[model samples]
Target chain A: AQSVTQPDIHITVSEGASLELRCNYSYGATPYLFWYVQSPGQGLQLLLKYFSGDTLVQGIKGFEAEFKRSQSSFNLRKPSVHWSDAAEYFCAVRDNYGGSQGNLIFGKGTKLSVKP
Target chain B: EAGVTQFPSHSVIEKGQTVTLRCDPISGHDNLYWYRRVMGKEIKFLLHFVKESKQDESGMPNNRFLAERTGGTYSTLKVQPAELEDSGVYFCASSRIAGGETQYFGPGTRLLVL
Candidate 1:
């Protein structure tokens, strides 16, 4: 079955530190990948997505993700961490069935905590 | 433009009671979706609607859950005789079109069953 795995359940980082959140997916074919972030008491927000072409994709809030097909991973990274960036991050893949962009299969999510 | 909006940000009810959740998608968005996250589990798809039609409901848990979108506008998900396992955060999302469009999600309705 197609699934997304976010290995890190929680991570703590100091302000200004670099941040990386791991995400791996299991799919039969080339899939559309996405990263979403949800802040406290807020809805899920799209960070970035990778459809095709360049392996590296930039998203909002200074976030970027690289799609590594060989490793079956699409890890999100940020050069420097911000206290406001502390939130729950989820990795998702579009459920491609019958050539239609169906629902998304999401990972368990990784919670990031920023310490000042 | 307003993003997706869900009603009753939080609800608490006893087992065997019925609760209804509402979602109003962004204007001009023809596709709406319903998803749920039970406690620590990942968010799971419950159903999909294209306008007023039900496109896919493969993720619906069981018959106790009923979703409807009338006039292709706002949608509602009714859970009758709610069970303890049904307690979770229900999310509503909308997209302009289908094919790989970005889905804008609502704040979600957190339901608790005693």
Candidate 2:
């Protein structure tokens, strides 16, 4: 079955430190990968997505992700972490089987904590 | 423009009671979806609606859950005789088009059953 895996359950980083959150997916075809973040009381916000073309994808809030097909991974990275960036991050793969309208399969989220 | 919005940000009820969650998608969005996340699990899809029609409900756990999109507008998900296992956060999302569009999500409804 198609699934997304976010290996890290919780990660702590000092403010201004570099950050990386790992994600791996199991899918049969070329997958559409996405990163979403949910702050305390906010909804899930789109960080970045990778469908085709260049492997590096840039998203809002100074976040970027790289799609590595060979490794079946789409890990999110940021050059520097901000206190406001502390949030729960989720990795998801779009199931394109039942058309592009296919439902999204999400991974158990990774919660990030920033320490000043 | 307003993003998706869900009513009753939180709900708490005893087992065997009924609860209904509402979702109002962004104006002009043709597609809406429902997802749920139990305590320690990944958020899973529950269903999808294209306007007023139910396109797919394969992810719905059982018949105890009923979802409807009336007149292609706001939608509601009603759970009758709710069970403890039904306690979770329910999320609603919308997009103008399905295949290649970004889905905007709403603050989820956190449900707790005693």
Candidate 3:
């Protein structure tokens, strides 16, 4: 089975400060990874996704993540986070079983708090 | 274009009552999925639909939960004789096709069982 772990339960950052959210996954083979953001009372929105491609994938809202196979990590980073960036972020992985359509396995999620 | 939409954003029902949730996928999306997040738990997959057909329903908890997509466009999930354990936020998502496509999610329907 495949699983994802997000170590941080909550993180607080000041506006214009850089931020990093750690994510680790346990999968037998190369896996498809994704990051999503969910504002309070809103549905999740895709921040970015990584399939077979460059190690560094850039996404919307000036966010990026690096896929490190050696560490089994795909950490999300943003140089300067705005106040609007405060939201709950989830790290997910796609699991393929016997050539069947796979579903996303999401981590518990990290709640981000942006301060002024 | 309008994104995925779910009806009855909030519902509160007593135990043993029935509840139904609806999801409307994107206009051309062919794949629809159902997921739920219980209190203090990660979101779990419940089922997936490819058009009007159920592509995968391995994650369904039990027969009490039923999902249908009659015309391959909109989908519905019904829980009969709901239990206290069934209280959670149910989310609906849709994708254009299968395999590696990004799925868009709806705001979700929050179900409260008292």
* Residue B18 lDDT (model 3): 98
Task: Give every collision pair in model 1.
Answer: none
* After superposition, candidate 3 runs with Cα above 4 Å error: none
- Sort by DockQ, top down from the best: 3, 1, 2
lDDT of 2 by residue, B7-110 (tens): 99999999999999999999999899999999999999999999999988889999999999999999999999899999999999998988667888999999
Clashing pairs in 3: none
Candidate 2 per-residue lDDT over residues A1-116, each given as its tens digit: 78899999999999999999999999888898889999999899999999899999999999999999899999999999999999999999988775437579999999999999
- Model 3 interface RMSD, in angstroms? 1.4
Give one digit per residue, the lDDT tens place, for model 3 in B1-114.
Answer: 999999999999999999999999999999999999998889898999999999999888999999999999999999998999999999999999776899899999999999
lDDT computed for candidate 3: 0.94
Worst 10 residues of 1 chain B by lDDT: B95-104
Native contacts recovered, each model: 0.84, 0.73, 0.75
Angstrom error of the Cα, residue B65, model 1: value is 0.2
Model 1, range B68-100, lDDT digits (tens) per residue? Answer: 999999999999999999999999999998868
The weakest ten consecutive residues by lDDT in model 2 chain A span A94-103
| TM-scores, chain A, per candidate | 0.96, 0.95, 0.96
